[model samples]
Target: MTVPSGIYIRKARIQDVRTIHALLMDCSKQGLLLPRSYNQLYSHLRDFFVLAQDQGAILGCCALSITWDDLAEVRSLAVAPECRGQGWGRRLVEACLSDAITLGIFRIFTLTYQAHFFERLGFQVVSKDNLPQKVWADCLHCPKFPDCDEIAMSIEM
Candidate 1:
């Protein structure tokens, strides 16, 4: 999808992994998002959508990972510091939501500290207990497992 100012969003390609990783790492450092390892990024590259300029710099990235039959998680969202308030983050998320619909998935959720941001996109705050599958499957492995302070937000399409 094309945004104003010569930037566009597209499915991530092999070449964009490093840049995507960097974007996530930067966000992680600021506690905006969780950090992902190179291993995870490479294996799930197809799950990502990247925002890039015409000159080919990756300005932001987000991922949509299928979690169950009708549920998916929107994760690894990050926008470059310079690009944060320009709607690119929303566009990246819309891309993921569109992809979920295309795949016949109707529910999408996110574990995030940015609750207000997701709320602006129509996601409502949800209880972690409502996501048992996610809790058992992935949350168990998270460093902040038992003490996960991230708010759980979800949108039903």
Candidate 2:
């Protein structure tokens, strides 16, 4: 995806945690994604990327978290409601995919309600059981744990 002029995609900075948290909160409230706590954001700040204006207004965020050797997961992808349809979401995920490649991780997956969106980005639906058991560590904390309704999708680079 071609990022439009005046928009910047960069590794998230320390100062971006709050804004990223807020964006994630908004997404979670809408059931688009799960909400992350400040502690979680601070701990995994290095895993994130933000799509922002040249002047520093954040419009979106995404994360590429290494889950295991040669494997990673794309999580917390969100774009401002007003910014939907502008390709920012695609750019955010693409950025994560690029990061995965750079880290030499060829397998990536995401658990999402927006399966169709991820599918457009080359992720294919897969059985949740196909993922490593370690991947369930986080799911134990999820409200949907034993009854997760989110789609599991993956792509191999």
Candidate 3:
């Protein structure tokens, strides 16, 4: 379902899982992102904030996973192909940032191929070596790990 922007962003519901999974898989298949298992989605359901209108059709998905006392990682930010070019991706990221700010988390980061896209959103390029070793836990599960070439970017709220 294509939901036009300009509506409120809210916490995702249990029923949104399957559709969200499909959204992630669509990006993953194109090698633009990682594929998340349904089990993982269920386990981290609360970590997500899905964008939709009053009717509640999931337009995009992004998760803010808390890591350590001062940092959080934004993962699996996939906007439907139809929704790209619009400001939906930025709005979704902004929603996560706003939520993080409310929770007192000011450091946010992401691993992505769309470096320029995120750069415009205030994310700066950073060396992967500077990231906490704990963050590598997820990388191990990625099909493209050490050899992976996604750029790492960060921002301070």
Q: Using lDDT, give the best candidate's number.
A: 1
TM-scores of the models, in the order given: 0.96, 0.94, 0.89
Error in Å for residue 76 of model 2: 0.3
Model 2 agreement with the true structure over 1-46: per-residue lDDT tens digits: 5657898889999999989999999999999997899999999999
Q: Write the per-residue lDDT of candidate 1 for residues 1-157, one digit (tens) a residue.
A: 4458778999999999999988889889899988999999999999999998899999999999999998999999999999889899999999999999999999999999899999999999999998988999888998998999899999999
**Which pairs clash in the backbone of model 1?**
none
Model 3 TM-score (2 dp): 0.89
CA error at residue 41 for candidate 2, angstroms: 0.4
Report the C-alpha displacement of residue 94, candidate 2, in angstroms: 0.8
Best by TM-score: 1
**Higher TM-score: candidate 1 or 2?**
1
Please list the residue runs of candidate 1 whose C-alpha ends up more than 4 Å from where it truly belongs after superposition.
none
What shift in Å separates residue 89 of candidate 2 from its native position after superposition? 0.8
Computed on alpha carbons, the lDDT of every model, listed in order, comes to 0.93, 0.90, 0.84
Q: Give the range of the ten consecutive residues with the poorest summed lDDT in model 1.
A: 1-10
